[model samples]
Target: MKSERERQLMEQAYAEIEKYQDLVHRDPYRLRYHLMPPVGLMNDPNGLIDWNGTYHVFYQWMPFRTGHGAKFWGHYTSPDLVHWQAEPIALAPSEWYDQNGCYSGSAIDDDGKLVLFYTGNVKDDQGNRQTYQCMAVSEDGIHFTKKGVVINLPDGYTAHFRDPKVWRKDGLWYMIIGAQSKSGDGKAVLFRSSDLCHWEHLGPIAGGNSKWLGPFGYMWECPDLFPLDGQDVLIVCPQGLQPDGMRYQNVYQSGYFVGRLDYGRAEFVHGPFEELDRGFEFYAPQTMLDRNGRRILIGWMGVPDQNEDRQPTVGHRWVHALTLPRELRLVDGKLRQTPVKELKQLRKQQVAYPNAVVANELRSWPGVEGDAIELRLDRIQLLGSMMEIHFRHAARLIYNSDEGVLTLERKSFVNGLTETRQCRLPRLRSLHVFLDTSSIELFVNDGEETFTARFFPYPDDRTMFFGAHGHLQMDIEKWEL
Candidate 1:
């Protein structure tokens, strides 16, 4: 049975769809194969926790329009991370407290029940922002019950207090919420809650030291902290950072720092800032510890700075997706990301090409036309640093070993929009690149690093290309996603 709030939000969403049905929708910014909606605008991934033997993923969903409005918690579950089952709307902004929207938050297991803690966004007559931290409980792992505001915005904190992520340590509950400093700097606040209702501020964790942290914008959204291999890692998506050469190109981005948490002192000390994923579109990432004690992370594939109204898929009906969950490990002071091994279930026929194929010019491969294909290149020799692997036309991903760069360029779509992102990798040998019709996941050097992105292309542009400035030899294998 649908709740009154759910029904109202559905009606409003449908009405908005009808109102904007005629307009040309924009293409989603995420790459193909990532878990994007068939249509609509998507943002921060929320409620990304394993409960009741199923992995539940909820996101900031705006169904009827192409932008953020009257947000609802869209639900999807997967026995494994590869195959996801889309469920109904979980939470709606039907109540007065959260009428404006139900913003981003996280999930936890209270005993055996699934508990969701989220932000209740409200606006007054003058359109001022009033945010409240609310709670909800789910029994069947599908439907949710709204439990009114559990924690209100304390004094000295601005309306930016949102995206609460909770965890248990030493039988005490701890939460990290993204917020802005009184000086208008982006920060994340830690709170201690014994019962999930009353929260006591633990003060700032890692955003105060400007020398090491830089001026990290005004607010850090979706802050996730976890223990990775004897080190505590803090992942934060901060806004208002100036682009330093190739870094922080996206309007907002996600990154992390290896640090130590001094719970007694109510402070966290960390090293310099480093990006979580060096990709074109990854933001508002959330992390949780599974039963196996592994810290798995997932992120929203779209950024708030990019406009999705111009994407072609909006005309068809969906916008963003979640990046494949990655197992994060801190190795020698560096964070290593590898796609969860459980994703192997998604691999059907394993096509192996052992012999190195040397090509002086561009070449094509047969049987690689499907919307999903996994390419594994063993010992790829990029004779010239300037080379590209083209997929589905208009989209070319280049790897420049000399410059330690990997770039994915998409043109001829979205009114000819082009974007490039690069990370420092001394030399590239083995490359595992996953290509879905609308998404791309690049695992460089056996997941020592990864770059996940989403893109949209016309149906006729489905072609693959391997271009080299000089002679190149690579062992390639393509798999159906």
Candidate 2:
């Protein structure tokens, strides 16, 4: 038996399939299973709210087209965050105020009701952008009713004001929106609201002419602010930042800054910018408070401005997916991310390595073939100049201490595009990696820093290898997906 709302959603989904049958019917991407979207093109996560034993996540979805066009709010709900149920389209850009698209925003549970706040994007006849801060409400957590604009673009702020992340502080509601300065600098502004209907600008929280904060591109997008280990952490994905040394490698990347907030003075005292994830694919991360009072985060696994048309799964209808929710904690003044323990529910067969296994030369683990698996390598002794690990098909991951590079190479992608990123390390000792069918997450030095990537593999590429010239020792544990 299905509820009326569930049946209505089913009918709506069927109708959508019929309407966009040409574009909606495609194969799934070949990357780790966690990185590829289950159905359609998905980007930034919006309206992440945990309410009444269920979690609702809205994303930047494009329904009618295969690429990024006609942005609509796609909804998904999960009781445990591992398995998701697709719901109806929460918001469509069918109205005048949001005819162009409905951009990214946040959600909150206001006294038992789910309140969604998102940016209503509008473009005029000249193709100029107009952003509006809008509101919606849901009682059953599946359907939403728009409440029009709650805040408008203010003076001194450019038209790029979008991605409003709302939170409750003390006794009032506060929002942090990504924006650009008049001189074309990226920043995030704060706002306050006594009632959900009215709002007041509180000026910039950070990212406006700081000596240490570098020119973080033109405008920051998807601003997320939360408290971790007694310090406020701000995560923002900025555009136009050129690669300087080992930072800002992706077309667009997400990072964070740990700081203290003085709400009375409307200012944020922060530290230098730090890359959140050192992976090939990760962008526009969103965070929320779960039922256990933990701050968990999820990020889009695809980069912006990349040639995704070459993705193998384009024929399958979906493109990207959200990373597994990770709990954030501040350790020794640095943000450490770890997968929640709930993910263990998805694990089946477990293989343990009780004693240290030496791979002085290249070694292979039999039956280590699957799209989904959890691997833990402890006390890794890298005695060679370089060592490589292969997953899926031609996905090669190398940790080279001699060259100070940790590279993930995928030659099987569209047009044989192989992307690699490296960070300077004194010496590589230990590595912990998680591999899903279409995604790979590497946690180095026990979560001191991490990398997240999405890869598309060929159907027959399930073999893995550990290649090294000199002696190497490691304790490896493999678990079924």
In terms of lDDT, the best-performing candidate is 2
lDDT tens readout by residue for model 1, 1-481: 4567668886776666566544423433334345665347777889988887888889898876677786888888888777788787788888887898999999999888899999999999898998999999988889888888988887767898888899899999999888887788888788998898888988887674353466678888889888888888888988888889878877787898888988887777888788877776688988877777788888887778575566556666666677888888887798877778887666766666566554567877676455566778887777775677877775677877678877767663456767677777777788777666677778887777777676666655667777877767877776776
Q: lDDT by residue for model 2 over 194-265, one digit each (tens)?
A: 888899899988874654476778888899999988999999988888898789888876888899888998
Stretches of candidate 1 exceeding 4 Å from the true structure: 1-7, 10-34, 208-212
Give the least accurate 10-residue stretch of model 1, judged by summed lDDT: 24-33
CA lDDT of 400 in candidate 1? 76
Q: Cα RMSD (Å) per model?
A: 3.0, 3.4
TM-score of each: 0.92, 0.92
lDDT at residue 364 of model 2 (Cα atoms): 75
Our model 2 lands, by Cα RMSD against the true structure, at 3.4
lDDT over C-alpha atoms for residue 10 of model 1: 67
Instruction: Tell me how far the alpha carbon of residue 404 in candidate 2 is from the true structure, in angstroms, after superposition.
Output: 4.4
